[model samples]
Target: MPATFLHRFVLSIGFLSLFHSAYSAAQHRSYLRLNELDFTHLPLDIIIQALISLFVIMYGVMNVAGDFKEIKASAELENKSWETFRNIPSFYTFSHRGKFLAFPHQTGNKKHN
Candidate 1:
């Protein structure tokens, strides 16, 4: 049921069929048609092409996966910052003075004095 297992099985079957047709000969077939080749008898060119294609496809997928991971982590950090800010009422004020924070009394309410 796994994708990898299915892929392997399909490749095996394809290779077997390719070679089977190449070397096996039918009873009524001529010399050219009777010839049957084995699955492992594939030409080097085909193997090289397969390898090149696999490399390119795998590389592209891995690159995309890495980028997705980075974006997901950044989103998580942003959400956490937002959550803390929501729970802390005094977290929003920012000033260039000696104190970067302000207390409730700093609101200039005379009742607190």
Candidate 2:
């Protein structure tokens, strides 16, 4: 779905609220430092404001992104040609453990009986 005016408005409000909360926390910390007070927990109201703003931002973003399409493997490969599945020579590997069974005597390691 296209991003409506309401969505943009909500997103803007959320961002503003989040910024305000962050600024308020910073100011609170500064105030405590100026008075030489111990650093303690943030006020409940600021925490609540931040959480609510985060939820609002999430809601606004989901609405603005539009609906997701269903993905199907069969549908994806439907138009592909058979020639695309053919083996490529550059990808071939001739070096493997099978060579040991085929030419054990040729190997330098002697068997201990």
* Top candidate (TM-score): 2
Model 2 over residues 1-113: C-alpha lDDT tens digits? 89999998999999999999999999999999999999879999999999999999999988888886658768766887888668668888899778778744655777789
lDDT scores for all predictions? 0.50, 0.89
Which portions of model 1 miss their true places by more than 4 Å? Answer: 1-34, 62-66, 70-113
Clash count, one per candidate: 9, 1
Looking at model 1, residue 11 earns an lDDT score of 55
For all predicted structures, in order, the TM-scores are 0.29, 0.63
Looking at model 2, residue 113 earns an lDDT score of: 100
The TM-score, computed over Cα atoms with residue i paired to residue i, of candidate 2 is 0.63
lDDT of 1 by residue, 2-80 (tens): 2354455555555555454444433223443456533334455545555555555554444433444455657566657
